[model samples]
Target: MRERVGVYPGTFDPVTNGHLDVIQRAARLLDRLAVGVAINAGKGPVFPLEERVELVRAETAPIAAATGCAISVVPFEGLLVTFAREQGAEMIVRGLRAVSDFDYEYQMAGMNHRLDPGVETVFLTASETNQFISSRFVKEIARLGGDISSFVPQLTLERTLARVRDQAGE
Candidate 1:
């Protein structure tokens, strides 16, 4: 049997619980899952690409072990489909948080399909409890000194708080 590989690409500025939820679910379905940490400069991430990758790698370590799935965290640049192709992933895993996310993801999936017919896009809806968590919101909460412990894992929570404090000179 051919090994099933999938890529879950995201700009995990600070890996959130919601992202981990998607990763956990996706990991169980694929033999090898590549957690693609995208370097999206336009978003002006609080954590650098390397830090983001490290945080994600740390948070996902447990999930990989528990699920017995091979998970690799790789920093990526350029088109997502191109990255997936390079990783030899047959599918792209997407996590949909709400209806708002659908419109954007639908277009992206269609375009990716057009770009490469072989790689399929699969959407996984966020777990009910995590549906409302977004990195943008989590950052806002952290910047305002609000508790974000539930939104992110311990490693991300600590790093994000430290980064926000450092940036604010607090």
Candidate 2:
């Protein structure tokens, strides 16, 4: 059987537990997985692309080690479908938090299909505990001095808080 390569693309402003859940799940399903840190300048991410990729790499290391799934964190710009094709990924894994995410993801899936008919998209529902957690919300909570340790990994939370403090000149 051919190795199944999958791409999970996201901005990953901060590597949250919810994102980790999806990564763990997808890692088990594919022979190899690539976490693509999208360079979305439009979103104005709090963490730079390099930092985002490093955070994801740190958080996902154990998952990859335990599952024996080859994984790499990479930065990509331009169309997701194009990136997936370039990575030789046959599947694009996405995490769906709720019904609200479906419409946008569904449309993107269709567009990806049109762009590359060979690559398929698979959506994994976020774990119940992580369903309400999002990077944006976590960042908001951190910026407002709320505890966000439960939502994000320890290292990620530390780095995010440090960055926030630095930006505030604290």
Candidate 3:
């Protein structure tokens, strides 16, 4: 049987808990999961591509080991559908936190389908505890010296705060 590989692509500026929740849930449904770190120059991410990739790898390691899922963190640029096809991903995993997210995701899903009819898009609703958590809000809170430990992993929170501090010349 062919291996079921899925790609979960995101900027993952600091790898929030909500992102990890989706990763963990998706890992169980697929034989392999590749967390694709998007290298979008336009997004102007606070964390560099490599840092984002490393953070995701570190955070997902335990879950990957526990689930026996071949989870890999990779950096990609350009079209997501193209990346998915190159990685041999049969599906693209997306997380929907609420009805607000569905409209945008639904449009993207349709575009991705048009790009590659063979690949499917799967949406996983965010867990109740993490439903409102987002990387943008987490970063904003951290930059303002608010505790973001609850929104992101401990390691990620530390790294984000340290980076923010460094940027501020602290």
Candidate 4:
């Protein structure tokens, strides 16, 4: 087995429980998992790249430790396939929560295959409990002063809400 490695790339402005679920499930399928945090300067991020990376790293540490699968927190600056190739990953894991995301993600997966036929994408359906969880939704809830502690980890919830409040001038 040539080291079953997978790369899960996303913006992950604030890591949510849904993302955690995907990572946990994907980790089981690979010997090493790379969660690539894509930094697109064109689309401004609520949490800076460093802070986002740290939050994801801290939250995923326990899982990585338990699974004995290395979790690398990388900043993706190019095409996702390119990043996956650089990391030596043979699979690109995608988390699908709704049908709406399918069209786009399917297209992306096809494009990735075209780029590197060796790299394949595996889609993991979101658990029913996490079907409604999204970073954008979490941020909106926190922005309105609603508690999102139930949706995300305590540390992440606190930091995300604080960031939202700061951005909203509240």
Query: How high is the CA lDDT of each candidate model?
Result: 0.95, 0.94, 0.94, 0.90
In Å, residue 86's CA in model 1 sits off its true spot by: 0.5
> What is the lDDT ranking, best to worst?
1, 2, 3, 4
> Between 3 and 4, whose lDDT is larger?
3
Which residue pairs in model 3 clash with each other? none
lDDT per residue as tens, model 4, 49-122: 99989999999998898888889999889899899999999999999999998999999999999999999999
Which window of ten consecutive residues has the lowest lDDT sum in model 2? 161-170
lDDT by residue (tens digit), candidate 1, 1-170: 99999999999978899999999999899999999999889999999998999889999999999998899999999999999999999999999999999999999999999999999999999999999999999999999999999999998898999999999995
Local accuracy of candidate 3 as per-residue lDDT tens digits, 14-91: 899999999999999999999999998797899999899999999999999998999999999999999998889989
Taking all chains together, each candidate's TM-score versus the true structure is 0.98, 0.98, 0.98, 0.96
Off by over 4 Å in 3: none
Per-candidate total of colliding backbone pairs? 0, 0, 0, 0
**Candidate 1 ranges with C-alpha deviation above 4 Å:** none
Q: Which scores better on TM-score, 1 or 4?
A: 1
